[model samples]
Target: MRLLHHSTSTDRPFHLDPAPLVRWVYVGRFSIATAIFVAAVLVWQDALTDTGKLLVASLAFAATLAVTAVSVVYSEFYGRALGPTFHYLQSVFDLFLVTAVVHVTGASSSQFAALYILVIATSSLLLPVGGGLLVAALGNVLYVADALWSVETPFTATVWVQLAVFAAVALGSAWLSAKLREAGKGTEAVLAHVRLQAADILYNIRSGIITVDATGRLLYANPMAEQLLGLDLDPYVGRPVLEALRRIAPELVDAVDRSMRDRVRTARAEGVISAIGRRFPIGVTTTYTEGDGRNTDRTTTAIFQDISDQKRIETLRLRAERLEGVAELSASLAHEIKNPLASIRSACEQLSRSTFTGADERTLTHLVMRESDRLSRLLTEFLDFARVRVARREPIDVAELAAGAVRLALAHPDRPADVSVVCEAPHGEFIVEGDDDLLHRALFNLLLNAVQVSSEGGEVRVEVEDASVKQLDVGPNFADGGVALSVVDTGPGIAPEIRDRLFDPFFTTKPGGSGLGLAVVHRATDVHRGHVFLDTGPTGTRFTIVLPRAARTMPRFTLGTSSATVLT
Candidate 1:
């Protein structure tokens, strides 16, 4: 994986630095001066050369060197203001100077004509593509004018051929320079695009990304990191990461610090962070970036993700597996104890009826009977939790079920008279396909729980409605439609410590409670492929059961409402 820090600068293929070119101008001035002196010496020594041609050649060289010296001074003093236009102006002046010297020294045949090529080539580097070609055209025109002026009569084909040669050289230099510039631009563009793509991957990726410098200062943090850590990151950049996250996400900085100090190239850790009034389980992976295999300039990059949902699902799965094992054991144990329990109850009843027994003996027998009955009830509850079955299924009205459960709960002899229970079915009817007995049992448990939790004079409301209208997320199974049954109690909410294990068998908070009511409710709903959710707060607690609606067309299984096949 290639890691990249964010950068704001745009890439450029070529940045024309004027310093080197200006230096080159000075070097060329010196070299040309030396060449001119040598040429002047050669011309003056040759007797064949006339005085006029020698003077013109020497004067032209002197003029060219003087112009170069002036340009060097101008560029050094005010180069920023002139930019590259100074080089261009010098190229134009050199063209005219070379033309003048060539015209004086023998026009078409002057070897000094080669000087125009140098002017055109240098101009191409300082100017744009069009400007380079324009300079080439200007050089061609000057060469033609020199050729025509040098001849006293009509021009020969040789002079025209020389003009053509000069034109070709000028055009060739301009074309080659433009190609070089474009090639540089293309290379830089490719590099820029690759850099942009890398930046996008770093910024837009799903995982949280954070980079801290060698001193544990935050260098870069992506948007996901800001959200996952729940911190205002804009203010914290370039600050110490440990200090920024000290109150909420200290573990993250600690992990990064450990990775930076360790010998390992990479480190991994998991922990819970409390931020924004919530806790999140995050998995962190820290990568240590080394600089020159030394401790200096080291960087630590941490990637993290929220794993709270994953951990909760894992816990639920583990609990389900454990409950399955317990159910298997309870089924065997219940069968083993049922017969002995029955014999004990029968013997106690027989002893209580005997006339020979005194009042104390009768009282002892009654006590034995009462204790045995309590044991029987406890065993029955254990059996109910251990073995849950749905042997029959049919379309039943959920509103009717809600009404029956509410009426039964309110009429119970143990129910508090000051508590009011009400049923609401605004739609009047909703159908769900499930075993009638099992559904009834699930609703009864929920209703009973609400009534028990309610304070005196408090209301317990049982609501039956369409789950789709409420927009409850009942998972993929109930995509078409479903019915919802909720039992709400106006009582103090469940304690946070007990909420997680609220549905576990044999787990209870109340004295002498069997602890299997919610467990049985969970099993009954599971057999029908239903979902249950709890909404608990300081105000009250609401238990909602969602079961998918029955299909319009009947299924292959036979419907039965009269009998239930007990699983145990």
Candidate 2:
């Protein structure tokens, strides 16, 4: 059988494969009626004239055959007309054919005349007022013509009464037809509005949408699909769903197809898609459903969303976690090694003080003591590196803190005479809220790192400027607000590769370095809800520490001179 084409104007077209069972019912009824009419003519042959009986038999046979052929043809061909208008035309033809059969038999007191009323009522459900009226007029004229010319019976009061009933049925059917047409128009308007709204929503959404039929043919693809898949939306309709998935990633096609075939209602996959030769992470969610009400089989829809930034953040978070673990380990080892280092230094100091007569003896003692002191200093740095805990918080004058650290560095007996500590700040002291001890340690570590890198006698500039503390822009946690203190050194700059992981634990360029100094500094800053940034260039590295500023009216705590001493 040929496939029927539906009219596009209807919101929903009626299309179904014709059922032979239904067709047989109508054919059987018509055949029984034809047989009955033929037997009736034979039985009345003696009572009626030959010519009259022959005419009756011929008309009965012709009406039976004509009705059967028309009914079968219409059931097969016209039922597929989708629009209300075409369906109305089909109903009209059906009514006209049924009325013609009624007219073929004698019209006066014809039992089959009632069939016209049934036809008109059924037609009213599908046809417009104009078509209904036209069909009714034609039926009425045929009824009148048959009544006037038929010889089988004379017009009776019953015939007149039936005609009145037929007229009333036609008029009422036409009015009902007009009402149905109006309702159909209203429904179309509502459906059209809904479709437009849905289109707009799909077009503007951030995620891409793709809908495919049971056969895996793409039915609809929105603008976002075009953007995410790097494919043209218009040309993709009716294409295989796998084709679009291939544009995103070949793996995606296989995943979706497998899920759909397995009747998976919901599934998600994350993968990278190459666009312009660069791979970007994308997340896809596929949803499957059988068509509504009809159980027309399953259809799958996939929504694509770009998640490259999210993946990058996840990677950074993992790296940060690993660094944290390393920081903890380094802190523990440093604590374990510090005690023995102090003992070695004391022993070497005692040896250096012992009496020695020759110049060579004095030089050898000096070298041994100097090297031991250096080892002691290295042990001290290791201890500092291993201790990454944040101290109790209090209000602190950053300038005074810097001054105190500089004083301690200057008072060292082995300090180079050429090294100078220069402090630049406005008249008002910049105050921040943090653990005083932790802040002090952080500042000292920064200064020491600066001093280590700088040439002997080189100037290490310390600037205390008011800087607002804010949250990290691209991290899991962010600080509220704080102050910043910068210690800039005129020393060899850090290399680029090391700069990325500068604050990472156990990442140090110095020989015998435990790499916990900056890590501790980072942890301290974090506990204070602050941030630390390193700016390195050809000139030197500048470590900027930002801590939340203390309220001006808050009470301050003072640590005595002995209390302020650094832990050995």
Candidate 3:
């Protein structure tokens, strides 16, 4: 019975019990008991010589076997149909069978007389308190009747004393069995409640959980697991998990199975799962285990967790690492080339200072000058791309910085005569925490780019808007609170292919352009922890810059001082 109950608890494969295995155990026990009775009858034939003994022995044996067989049949095929009331009646029948066996064997002295108490005790363990007590009471009544009927003479003192003792023992056993059964029930109830609470907790958790057996059968799956797999729970259980997996993701099954067979306690794999026509990154982790020594043949448990967000973060981290390496290489190359370029520029200046005689000499000098200027421009662009140094940040008025950039842009040799610079902002100055020179340079580049892109007589609108910090969706690390400076142009818009790689070094669309203007802007934005965005369409190109605001107590950098050279 104990083994049967244990098997029912742990080994049953289906979700619900459509057939009760307990009935088969009862039937086998009934057959053994019938065989014992038959053997007893054959061995004790002499003792059953009298008519009373013959009738009692034959009737008791037949009655006990009949009751046991009936119990097994009803419990197996008709238990659910019988309902609670009929089930309780079956306990009554078992009590009657035990009483008849005690009466036939000898009311008080027979060894089998104690069998009635055993039956009652067993009944108490199997049934609820009301049913157990009903059987116990029935056994007590039968014991009293058997004792009274076995008396040879009426009202003997010794006979009465024996009857009284037997009755007391029967009652005592019944009460003890009932009390023990209640205690056992209480303990089971507490354990069941705890298990239910644990199941609830697992279901409500946000992290995905899937537990599979050694046979590749999914034994347990939580709500999160269902959502992650996009499976409905009702139809998922008891199905070959691998077959179901092929419908969702086939790659996972092979990896998970391999990990389990190799006794791999933990391993991680990543892939993409298609959901609603879109691909989502999925991370799978498997854990394996053999059962405890007591249940060595039991199934293994593997828990899976989803880590898509973590995978995305790691991917971004690797990309940033690559970008850093490229920046370092560019900086190294720029540094190596700048020293020689400086010497060449110095030698050209010396040649210009010397005497020139004819047209050919003048033309040679002019060529040297133009080539030197080109070399200088190339060196500047390379330095901007390298951007090796950290920012020496301080507080500066954004409006004043914008004014300085405008002055520098207008002073250029190729400045358009019809181009106009306009600033639309609040009267009170807005301060930003950044390197003034880098900010000036970035703004100057953007203004120069805007001027070059705009047509003659076109207005270059420069607007500084102060509001709560908002992030533009296009760039990495773009989220922060800051003031936005927009330089809007009226000219031919940027091409689609060029917009994607605008900040890339040495990429340009203009004929004689160095192609470092936007790249330099990007580096300066990085230094200040700000962001730059370009929106180009059929109308024109709009360049927007965002910078973090500085607190009032910080000292501010203004024009025309030793610090002013730093902003030049």
CA RMSD of all predictions: 21.7, 21.2, 21.7
- The order of the candidates by TM-score, greatest first, is 2, 3, 1
Which candidate comes out best when scored by TM-score?
A: 2
Pairs that clash in candidate 1: 418-457
- Which ten-residue region of model 2 has the weakest summed lDDT? 559-568
lDDT of each: 0.71, 0.63, 0.61
Highest-lDDT candidate: 1
For candidate 2, write residues 378-450 as lDDT tens digits: 6676666556566566678888998888887667654567777777766664777667888888888888888
Where in model 1 is the C-alpha error above 4 Å? 1-324, 327-357, 468-474, 551-568
Clash count, one per candidate? 1, 6, 0
State model 3's lDDT: 0.61
Per-residue CA lDDT of candidate 3, range 207-273, in tens? Answer: 5666556665666677776677687654545444767765676546655665565555555555455
Candidate 3: segments with Cα more than 4 A from true spot: 1-38, 47-93, 128-130, 144-197, 215-217, 292-306, 330-568
Q: What is the TM-score of each predicted model, taking all chains together?
A: 0.38, 0.48, 0.46
Residues 482-552, model 1: lDDT tens digits:
67688899889887778878877667778777778888888888778787777788878888887877644
Superior candidate under TM-score, 2 versus 3: 2
